[model samples]
Target: MKFTRRLFLGLAALLLGVGATMAHAANALDTIKQRKKILVAVDIGGPPYGMIDEQARQVGSDVEAARLLAQDLGVTLQIVPVSGPNRVPFLLSRKADVVMASFSITEDRKKVIDFSEPYGVVPVVIGGPASAKVASFADLSGKTIAVTRGTTSDQELTRGSKGIPSVSIVRYEDDATTNTAVATGQQDYIAAPPSTILAVKKASPSRDIASKFAMKAYPYGIGVRKNEPELKAWLDGWVKTNLKNGKLDEIYKRYFGMSLPPEVLQ
Candidate 1:
């Protein structure tokens, strides 16, 4: 009888310990409320998504979206500028509460982190000087393509160019550097989103860059750390409200000069 009683007592203690662990687990929403700020990671390297304005201040679609999130949550917004490759790592390392870095939603990324419903869409494309004849993936043979590491463009180019042994894929750390390669003539072709290609043209007007072909368009979402149901749910609802109210589209049009994809709006 005493042994059974001790066993029961041990089980009860374990249950209490488990309960405590669960209670102490981090809930990002509550933490944000407690701290009165939401740290959002953004990549200013990419323009129209995130970039610097004439006043040297951060301004772009992603930047405005982050502000909206903080405004609606009643928290101060702290933008943590990051490179494209480090967006997920920053969130996982707790350096940022969320990632608003034009983060493309992908099956591979969803395996590690959680994403809110898509708020915007960006089309990936292969762009080069107007003189380059690269209308299709097959035409990439014997040409070099620059891409930002860890981006969908990089992945698509790498995968699609495997059959073309002569195609050389050069990877840069961020969109800014990738675009620079094209502007300076260090590389003739770039795999990036259309907005980034447009920024490249705007920066180097003499270069006469143009999109050669369109790849798949990807929907982007707010990235939250896994297991933060409260934060994820709140973000989902916030996205829905803003998307429905046309605020998200408004921000997109301001930067992209076009409406959000019809599918994303639905």
Candidate 2:
């Protein structure tokens, strides 16, 4: 009887040890704190959200937001550059602690990863040079549209052009390439956020690129891996605090030249 009791006690102790180890491994916030650094993924190629300034420094709304997060956490910030297609993959693979690369909150993305409260909004649009007939989907019957692969813009465009059989859709690996395709006249139109369309205009000033139609605006969120309740909760609180204090608005205005939506502010 004593031997059986001894064996039971040993088993209980082993179980407790295993449980503790699992809990420790799951708490990413603690691990970040212990490491004194947070790895944030940003798409540096996308301007206004993530970009390199003339001074050769990363300066963009998402980069600033990541910096603020690291500052509040009392940890150093290490940016992991990524593209639209790899944003979720990087987070799931543990290559990044958080993703702030203008990541839009979508029903489909939510199925794979968790997103914090939205920090900003992106107005997606279909844009082309002034001469291109792109006032509506019907106008795009014979035109080619370029979009970044795996981005919300691509999904929205695909859904919006369902019946436009003559419209050709071309996918690029990143926002820069997608915008460049339209900027250089390789594609007749580009389905992208307004900020990126503006970038396309700047890249080819002679083209007079402008948005032909609005394609719905989506709120941007910070992405974290699934099953990270603690980390996600902390981010949610942080978003609320920043939104109320005007800091997030300040960053938004700095890049977007506008205030956040009323619903988002509340």
Return the top candidate by TM-score.
2
Alpha carbon lDDT of each predicted model = 0.91, 0.91
- Of candidate 2, the 10-residue stretch with the lowest lDDT total is 129-138
| Count of clashing pairs, candidate 2 | 0
**Model 1 Cα lDDT, one tens digit per residue, 221-245:** 9999899999999999999999999
Q: Count the backbone clashes (under 3 Å) in each candidate.
A: 0, 0
Root-mean-square deviation (CA) per prediction: 1.9, 1.1
Candidate 2's TM-score reads 0.97
Best by lDDT: 2
Off by over 4 Å in 1: 1-18, 21-24
Per residue, candidate 2 scores C-alpha lDDT tens digits across 41-68 of 9999998999998999999999999999
Model 2 misses residue 89 by how many Å?
A: 0.7
List the pairs of residues colliding in candidate 2.
none
